[model samples]
Target: MAQARCPLPSLLLVLVAVVLLVPRAAGYPWQVCGNTGSFTANSTYQANLALLAIALPKNISSSPDLFATTIVGAIPELVSALALCRGDANATTCSACLVTAFQDVQNVCSLDRSAAIYYDPCILYYSNDDSFLSSADNVASASTNRINLRNVTSDPARFNRLVGALVNATAEYAAYNSTRRYASGEADFDQEYPKVYSWAQCTPDLTPAQCRVCLAGIIAEMPRLFTDRVGGRVLGIRCSYRYEVFSFLNSPVMVQLAAESGNSGSPTPAMGPTSVTPSAAGGGEY
Candidate 1:
């Protein structure tokens, strides 16, 4: 018989030391696996593993309320957590990004028990202990697209206009948005092509006001952290902000965030990135 295909984004194996994950045509975002480990055979360990795997994202579609249910049921635990980065990202891209992060947790954390994953547009968290629910207090994670800005200081006026709009619009969107939990926009500059392409988002679970607080914290750090030639950003479990001179998001987001929205307040003199404690975990490290 043809192999029974694994339909969802899952790794399944039974009665043996093995793993089988169906190839996802989609791509996942840039994620970090905070920590994770392999399981030895035993009733207790198996039960714990199952509990953490209680409800993956695909299952949520069938029972949307499952996310907030009790974390324990008999011996099985249900502490799964998943967040989409930006709706503009495609299913394939998101899938690929997630898989990359999953691999990290599996590889480095082969011995550790707790695990976390970070994707450019999403985050997946699971553990045998803490249920991260209602914990908007986790610290932030940061990274850059690795590309520099085209010409921020070199071409001051145009660069200022582009950055100003993105910083402002994204802050507003995160403060008040929908299931997408995202905001993105662009602005024109006098020197080069469309001056900027930008995007921002927070996990939907956060209240509108809470989202604002989280994103604002990140924005406050941009000036000094901001690289004049390349795109840079600070990513966190609750929120993320990013932009590039070139289009980097899905079509819808690309259209919206790359439209050259005009300038905002006078550009504050760029400052330095202050020291902020990095979250104990960004992506899991073995």
Candidate 2:
């Protein structure tokens, strides 16, 4: 049999919106073990990876940008690693999350020569190949809430249009308006579901045009993956987006839009049962 090759690490781009109240939990992480190659138990590559585990977290926590990339060891045995924490995360949280990620990748991916791991608060990726450090390819993964929007079943098209506008606007702000490449906003929808909240973010290292391209790739997937869902997210190594009916992000929403008028939309239905929190974390290997 021919040997199979693992695909390149997929970028996860998340766009989420929630309906019912879901309990929030940290949840399990999504990980990809690359097909590039492997390292021996005590090889020089292993030593370099170990050094990165300690150094990356410290560097990211200390930097105002909350992002860091490093190259360790000479070529052949070299390792390149990058880490990014969500914009709203505190320094303490960013540091702690990366420290845990470094330990977790080893357990989950073992001695793989390259790997990528995703969590709610952060992302960590390392490899013998450095091409990914600057590349913003469209490889992607997405997650959606289990519940549908309360009114979406009545008028899915309208709901989708609103979501597209909100997400696209947020993406523009994250790319052009925010130095950190992060943005959150809300738009008025209907009387029953009065507001929709959304967020967008990209790794700070990407240029504005690169950031826009990264986010647009994921947004194009929204109609297929998240049309009527109350909450969904697409996560990419380079960029990500999320939306919810209820507010899930921090204070000071970055952008706001008024509800569109003139549409005699369908009658608002009774609210769904509350108290169910959407799953906070989910992903799949590409």
Candidate 3:
């Protein structure tokens, strides 16, 4: 039989199409460009923002808490910025995430004087208004995987109850027990999906009460946002929580619990507490 071959141009075109059609593994970043105002190019506000982009990443990566806030310039040109890395993210990852975030926000928001950009590893926000640097009052955004849990369809109410218990406990641990204001835990469910993993975090600068309130605000939206989904996350400026059927967190689970037998409401903590020691500098936090 004669050998078959694709034309060079045709083969190249097909390859290009395939590459272009492939989805980004990390997914697209979520961003909000504030309507507060816009800054003109080459303005002092733009210059101050440029300085912030360089300073925040360095400050956050070096900080023990993996969080940093700064104000550059003075008066109307002041640019206040905050950057926070996920508790499990290493310094390198945190720095890189923020560096890219600054670039991404500038590109996505263009000349907007206030904007926030979020990624899996970190979040960056800068504004002419300094209140955002300390306030936890921002609205949260939810991201849910399209696939529903196969096991949950059989008993959605039970699944919902379990999810509520898992996230609430995780939030409590993050707010109260964790030094970094972050925690991850697992809950035992039915056999079909034996476990549900959850993670909760808040900006380390926030007080325990503030963290709890911030997390509570987002948790309240779960029924409307997550339901029986296999995975979902609510991301906010000050706090966030994520849940999945499969494990998506680092080791040393901070809390473990099992659903009570029969038609009980909440899960009970498993015996023996698990503690996480904070990692060394350049590594992740507890």
Each model's lDDT comes to: 0.50, 0.73, 0.76
lDDT per residue, candidate 1, 75-164, as tens digits? 233333454535555555555544455455545444344455555545555555454566654443222223354555445544654574
The list of candidate 1 runs beyond 4 A from truth reads: 1-47, 50-54, 60-80, 90-100, 128-131, 141-153, 157-161, 253-286
TM-score of 2: 0.76
Index of the highest-lDDT prediction? 3
TM-score of each: 0.62, 0.76, 0.79
Model 2 spans > 4 angstroms off: 1-27, 138-151, 262-286
In every candidate, how many clashes are there?
Answer: 43, 30, 0
Candidate with top TM-score is: 3
